[model samples]
Target: ILSAVDTFGFHLNALDLRQNSESFEAVLDELFAAAGVTAPDAGYASLDESAKRELLVAELTSARPLVFPWSQDFSADTERELGIFRAAAQAVELLGPGVVPHCIVSMTGTVSDILEPMVLLKEVGIISFNPAQQRLVGSVDIAPLFETIEDLKAGAEILQELWEVDLYRGYLRGREDVQEVVLGYSDSNKDGGYLSANWALYDAQLAIVKACDTHGIGLRFSHGRGGAVGRGGGPTYDAILAQPEGAVRGSVRITEQGEVISARYGTASTARRHLEAFVAGTLEASLLDTESLKEPERAYGIMRDIASLAGEKYAQLVRDDSGFIDYFTQSTPLHEIGDLNMGSRPTARKQTESIGDLRAIPWVLSWSQSRVNLPGWFGVGTGIMRWAGEDETRWQDLRKLYQAWPFFRSVLDNMAQVMGKASMNLAQIYSTLVDDPTVSQRVFNTILDEYELTKEVFFRITGHDSLMAGNERLERSVQRRYPYLLPLNAIQIELLRRYRAGEDTFLVSKTIQVTMNGLATGLRTSG
Candidate 1:
């Protein structure tokens, strides 16, 4: 806490309290009932976006409080959430502005989702309209986190709608016309694949930029990146530079979690290096027009094609294949990983076979443990192959694009690093753990085929015969780690075999857990 205060002053790190938008709606429903008044237009949930916006605008524009201390009748969860907002209001009075700068609503799909939190903030006295001044007063920014691919695609439309409302437009003026939107890297990647996720995010940002421009709003993007490629992890500097033009817009935020936090900030010198890289990258992205060389429309079209083809291929293997779940459970240390307790967040959103329920960290970590790193490179090869085919000209165009486009270059480079670290032989060994030989062979063969194709495509684009060819230092460093990783992989496979064969003992489970940690450390990635 002291360190945070020292670095960021009394406001500290500016906590962003997040919850599902539905939860906020439920809270508002209870609040309405407790106040003994019908909602402005029926119940909050039943109201359409236009009604909700109109109601919210009326409430925010009034000086009257929605809920008072005497009327604080609500369920335990609702009360707790309200108490948090009330505390935040108090904190602003005590610690000054910036203590809690944002209340992020996750799974935000509609204008109502954004307005729901704003109403709660008004109830807590964090936001109010001044009739004399004709403006809203508030310190916290209510950011909507768009997670799934569908949400990302619709992000611009949602923001545009929010800005169109006269009341919300006035509120934006109070915020100096600045709006923050969070894009979820992990969820989208899990929903689609790496290529589709990247393309969706890029297109979303482009559309959002245009929307913000049209509304005369300053846009700030918060990237929900994780410590794996599937979760938008890569060299921080390159990643920032690779963002869609105007996406950075002088300010940006990204989540650094798990091993990434430690790896970047564990030491003073390392932290300095990482911070310097971030600052430099941000400045370059904000000031420089990196998209001049490539035609934006042309690039977008190519990426769209690639993402569509790649996403389909990825869905075929992971989603369409019924035996994939069994293969994943057997081939990787997913079950053991849960017991490792590496994080406070639940491994799965719910108990289900659906990939959407599984968090991205474990998704990529599982693949990393098996030495396949499938999440990073799976559908990319197929996508490239389908696009290029036997056309030498198309292949040449890709190489030129890789050279000129920061986004394309970064994607290929990151994939190369992940692919270089993968061990097909080790991956094959893990495939044996699958119960049925036919299923195992079928999936494994597909993976192997894709892996080979990915390598071929990567080399073709990079003009290199081998992975990490130009960066010998990094290549050597990764190569050195591979031999050490083999023992842990071997141990993990044996332990998985024993444990799955009904030897589910404490020691066996513990060993498998330890091996998982070792592999993640050695690989410098977590799912």
Candidate 2:
């Protein structure tokens, strides 16, 4: 629907499972409605083979590229879902007039063993890769996890094994049918926790780059990132530039997710600006690869170590601490997320009360509400602060990283937004969920002090008051959203109290669902 001749674009490619029997004309009518070409549809879109083909034909005639839905993994039983995606791609290929079909692959956690990446390429016949490694580790500590160096070595072994099985090994090395490989970050980061996830991702990308270089593969990495930095959301321009040299070769693709899509692409001017940032960021990264920007190996190692320690502390708080899970579930509106019906994906994999079973949206959302925002910046400040105090060279490397690497810079930028939104005073309003006042106070005070110290360190490094510079619109938007959030928070608190006071189970469930709906609508993003 975005018609500007900018470096960005989007198209709606609906695959309806609820009503796959609808007629072609009826579906075309629906696309018209969803795209706002006609009016908003009174009903959701339907999925019919003929209808999908017709839509694809129409889109192709307009020179628009269509992204096929491949959200379901290989084991999906919804034959309709599987059939529609495969059929659409085949139609695109057979028509083959001028349109290029985009393929996507996602892994579901049900697989007892790791999935072979090449299976996706063989089955789909087109490569659109986004692996969900982070979600795989359900009950394990992911941070400081690789501190023994053996972890990295073992990871390398996995990389070698994957290289043997992946189509990229053949294609990047001059085999056929391999056009691109997309790397995922958000889900993986959530699974690995912050410190481990970030490092793991960096290592993975670096390894891929090495593989491509060694084999002469023309690889285009499409980053599956999200709206918040904790979910791999950050300043796009800076993040792209931070790529290890030779990793990015002008071509880049990243997901515009959740609240960020509306914030950046909601309007004409803002959308155009967003496109410009991508083009600008890609160019800057491509042009600038110099010695001054490189982190000394020793300094980088120290930063990694501090990050590992910090991540361990963070993981211990969330995963190992007793009653923290109860506090999380009872203190926030997370229980209601499953019933909210906001996203295409379920909130949990199965019926379970564990944090590992909880979806990342509600996980990040709860922390965001309590104002702890553990995902955005839990270990970072302590990691950096500790490193700076101990070694001057390490501190210098941190500064260079902020200035040079797009990834580190984006991390800091996201932290600033989190700080602006989070308030310890307001968080105290929600902390009353914990019956133990001493524990509540201890946790709250520790988080708040760390947040402040982190902000000071960030300011010292970036010399900025906040993330958005000269962006009054964003500031105003956050302010407006904050007031709206307060009502949802109060509702959640009341609902929780009643539920605990022996309220009817059904009523409690409905209340939780309603609270989720209101909060998601108000925030405009799940987290």
The C-alpha stretches of model 1 lying farther than 4 A from their native spots are 1-7, 36-43, 61-73
10 residues in a row with least lDDT, candidate 1: 36-45
User: What's the lDDT for candidate 1?
Assistant: 0.86
**Each prediction's Cα lDDT score?**
0.86, 0.55
Model 1 Cα shift for residue 493 (angstroms): 1.5
lDDT of 2: 0.55
Give lDDT tens digits, candidate 1, residues 118-220. 8888877788777887877788888999988899999999998887777777887888789999999888888888888888998999999998887678989
Top-lDDT structure, candidate number: 1
Model 2: worst 10 consecutive residues (lDDT sum): 135-144
User: Candidate 1: how large is its RMSD?
Assistant: 2.7
